[model samples]
Target: MLHRLKEFYDGPNKDAKKFYNLVEEANQELYPGCTGFSKLPFTLRLYLLKCLHGWSNKSFTSLLKLLKEAMPELNIPPSYNKTKSTKIDACLNDYILFRNDHKDDDFCHTCGASRYIQSTEVDSELVPSKKQHRVSAKTLRHFPLIPRLKRLFMCSKTADSLRWHEEERSKDRKLRHPADGLA
Candidate 1:
């Protein structure tokens, strides 16, 4: 599956507008010292879209070369070590645009952890603990954690988290420490 997908990303497409536009625009301008048309031998627009699909930087270039059909002119972005901020921004924008098109807002997006809340008013007779301990991003403002808890899925840095860790540590200390200090 991975190999097949990689091939598709690097595959040639005569229908690519960006590539044609760049080529046409370059010839019209015919200006020197400017890369109006891609110096790349093959169409990079397809690979650019695929690169946004979240492949590793190395894999992206590897697949690009395959689709480029050995077009030495298919100048994809350089390696991360030599990467420039502007180029990165462009890559990210392309990725975001591609991603946005493929995403469904109504569907369960995997932006963060998955949680389901079920509220049931249990019978007051049988169950003892009436207190609810679970937290949710939806009810974060009501919780003591406030702003920090608002990002429940990514709340490792929250101030209240320290309290929880501290409490757990104390519990461990109790288990480790013997009443008679025999060890």
Candidate 2:
């Protein structure tokens, strides 16, 4: 199924060819010696399970340590926190996204709301502080889409399934899948 899909993508369509090449490159990086999930290494399988179950880094480390004690030759996988993510401070009142040019701004331009939580301590004659730690009033966590989409095409089974509508769908007048219906 994957071979047929690859052949179809490798045809005259330059965009499809580029997508196939990118997916192949990502697959090589993600699964080096393995072609599919069944052939993946024990450590990789554990890591996938850890990601799927949303296991904490500390919990995963503890599990790996226990596994190492039982199986001395077990290869330790890299940390699960390798995925890139960004946290942006947003306006609490106006719901304005403070990013890029407005990243360093102290207050929201739209609502005139302070970006950081107000300090509650009163100024005293005895104590004088130069700076106070500022916490964002609201934060938005962002995860990149391209890397995640690439991951979806990393596995042969997943890649084949994703392209099923284009590669394996019937060309007749009957509709079998959702892709067959006209929008």
Candidate 3:
């Protein structure tokens, strides 16, 4: 298991090189001129495997375990770390443009209210703790929009209309997309 994990991370094989190249491009763009070592390659590889190969969160955690068992020297992030995945997913979402048409109000569209406070009785019954406590009550699984947009750009068979904005791209372009008009 350790040998296989190291092969995937540091081997000179074609697939390993491809993985290295992907991480290289991402880190170069994210931290220009950064040449120091980082654990990001491992993290990004996990993320890519999940995205490209459709690995579930549980599967991802298992991979980390295998890597740890084999290497015993790696610093894999903690299992079930919500913040790690959230930060990576947020970075991936930055390039996406929202297409939904909605009013700019804090109120919910369905309830037309500013907030939906849960009942204190229900909260106490569920928590049953005197001291304040925090818990993650929900997790949302979403297909990131930016990668879908990037795939459109990668395919040579796409219509020219998709690249129409490239010719008119400006260094300081303003209000070029609907999102730019958002408050």
Candidate 4:
């Protein structure tokens, strides 16, 4: 491992060393005192349960407070905000992704459909002084690929599994795996 680290540091590509450093830093911050592919931390497990059961913020907070009081030694986050995931909204009619250049667009360019649901309750006679709250017509949650891939590679078992084809594949001239047939 030390030899690999040294080679990475002295590699021709500067980004490779930088990426290696970042992965190592992430491993430390994520695992901390834990060793050898342990179970998910209590806080993370609780957060997952909250999300899965759709627990309200008040309920989740109460549970955390109770747990903290009962187990003073355990480190529990005050709220679920610590484990927030990324999400984005998109056009409902055309399914046009609203991001980057089209982030602020109020309507879809392809279908000309409104991005937000039109409020029918608002009275036109009493034009409100402040902007009315708008709800998205539809939402599409997208998980980023890089962070997930980094997490998979961080685990020794998963990393080895990812490279199984290359390291453990039969070298005989026979089509065993699907990839072996690729030109």
Better of 3 and 4 by TM-score: 4
Encode model 3's per-residue lDDT on 1-183: one tens digit a residue: 987887677548674575566444333322333333235544666778788998878887787778768866555554636315432111112332111232223234554433223334446666676554322222233334554466466667573668555654553648877644547
- Which tens-of-lDDT digit does each residue in 21-84 have in candidate 1? 5444323321234344333212234445555787676776566556455644444434432222
Q: Relative to the true structure, how large is the alpha-carbon lDDT of every model?
A: 0.40, 0.65, 0.49, 0.68
Off by over 4 Å in 1: 1-48, 65-69, 73-183
Q: What TM-score would you give candidate 4 relative to the actual structure?
A: 0.47
lDDT by residue (tens digit), candidate 4, 80-109: 554332235688875687876788999999
- Stretches off by above 4 angstroms in model 4 are 1-45, 63-85, 92-96, 99-101, 113-147, 154-156
Q: Write the per-residue lDDT of candidate 2 for residues 21-95, one digit (tens) a residue.
A: 544433342233443432123445676788899998888877867866775544343343422123568999855
Judge candidate 1 at residue 170 and give its lDDT.
Answer: 51
Q: Which one wins by lDDT: 2 or 4?
A: 4
Of 3 and 4, the candidate ahead on lDDT is: 4
Number of the top lDDT candidate: 4
Order of candidates by lDDT, top first?
Answer: 4, 2, 3, 1
Query: By TM-score, highest first, what's the ranking?
Result: 4, 2, 3, 1
Q: For this target, which candidate reaches the highest TM-score against the unseen true structure?
A: 4
Candidate 2, residue 31: the lDDT equals: 34
